[model samples]
Target: MHAKRKTALAVGAMLAPVLALSLPASSASAHGYISNPPSRQAQCAAGTVSCGAITYEPQSVEGPKGLTSCSGGNSGFAELDDDSKGWAVTSVNRSQQFEWKLTARHSTSTWQYFVGGEKIAEFDDGGAQPGATVTHQVDFGNKTGQQKVLAVWNIADTANAFYACIDVNVG
Candidate 1:
């Protein structure tokens, strides 16, 4: 073989593995969603609520860090934005435990909970990577009756966050 051709082939082979290792993991495999209390996306994935693409990928509702939309402004998962979609309302006490089932752990900044456009609670992780599952006991305060709670997982390394909206009837 020509010397130049042989050198080029060797370089390509050496770079292949490095390139592969630098690629990001699949989004679906790198994110998470609320499981307990059953967030809207969770309902879709569990077939409790009929949905589109979100039905297969509940952990992928990611968007800019401060977005309030349940679908994370992702048009493909717009069904989550429809308050009239008949999402099952979970009945719970005033102080509730919210559980997040993480597909892959990620470095976190903070976990925020919102209701009626007001931040009800926030947990700071100090940019540490979380475990396979995370749970936060959030007090509903004076708020009660039917409410839509928005949960956001802020990633420390990125300017984006994962979102889940859970409908609940607090007793």
Candidate 2:
């Protein structure tokens, strides 16, 4: 009985490190979609855009107080009227390539976009309504290990705030 107990304790200690190493890392960054598997046959456009999955994060704001009844004011207001921010982290092979598509929605308003904190694109939907989607394609460039990416949205201010940001990975 003493021998059996000693063996059990030794086994438990040996397994601890293996179990801990298998756990996933906790990070606030979002993961992007991977549309295609990494392969030598894969080619990027102008060596900038690559094949990869796309993910989206939605955001919104409150409508203006007195303008509640105003046209297009029903869907609340948009914060970051000029710029909103989002982030993501991805693990990639040294030679892997990827692209991204982003979108925004508002019934009575228009929204602009930025990547890596730089203005890259914009969309003007007529009103501040919903269901509006914008798309952009970007190349991951050359990267290894884990990489960080950012997306931002800009829209007019009102009552409710509106915004969406997403991150993805391609390897």
Candidate 3:
């Protein structure tokens, strides 16, 4: 019995490091969403935009890079893609500031804003970790009328990004 106990202890000791090393790596910033101008997901949670699961986890709109969809190209957030859902449209000027509320701050590569499939603006973080919140100013140039803006938060050292869609009326 003593020999068996010693063997088990040794096995556990040897496995501890391996188990720790095998654990999944976590994102430096786990979750975040656009609040000002109110991203689709945020509005959903606020009850201003009717949605499904996104209403529960608005800050978790994570997906691979290059997704232009409002739902981050994720089916779980498909409600964001439905224009008929009466998403609250925020009125904005030609130049506007967008606020990102991060529950977990992660290393960031860049922040991009797109309108009608065109890149309107981008802010580079240069591989540095961001703060609890980030704000970006966007200029619409000459574009006007109702716009669906797709915002992307590119994570440094990772292939993933956080996406948000903000509907706005720009005059």
Number of clashing pairs, model 1?
0
Arrange candidates by lDDT, highest first: which order? 1, 3, 2
Off by over 4 Å in 2: 1-108, 132-161, 168-171
Q: State the lDDT of candidate 2 residue by residue for 1-171, as single tens digits.
A: 999999999999999999989998552232121223311111121122221221122122223332211111323212212121222234544333333222333333444333345444445555554433333444454433433333323334433332232233535
For each predicted model, how many residue pairs clash, with residues at least 3 apart or on different chains? 0, 48, 1
Off by over 4 Å in 3: 10-29
- Candidate 1 residues lying further than 4 Å off, grouped into runs, are 1-28
User: lDDT at 154 for candidate 2?
Assistant: 30
- Candidates' lDDT values, in order? 0.96, 0.33, 0.89
Report the lDDT tens digits of candidate 3 across residue range 39-134: 888888898866788888888888899898887778888888888888889899999999999987878999999999999999999999888889
Pull out the clashing pairs in model 1: none
Superposition TM-score, candidate 3 onto the true structure: 0.87
Q: Looking at candidate 1, what is the lDDT of residue 19? A: 94
lDDT of 1 by residue, 1-171 (tens): 699999999999999999999998655445899999999999999999999999998999999999999999999999999999999999999999999999978899999999999999999999999999999999999999999999999999999899999999999
lDDT, residue 89, model 1: 99
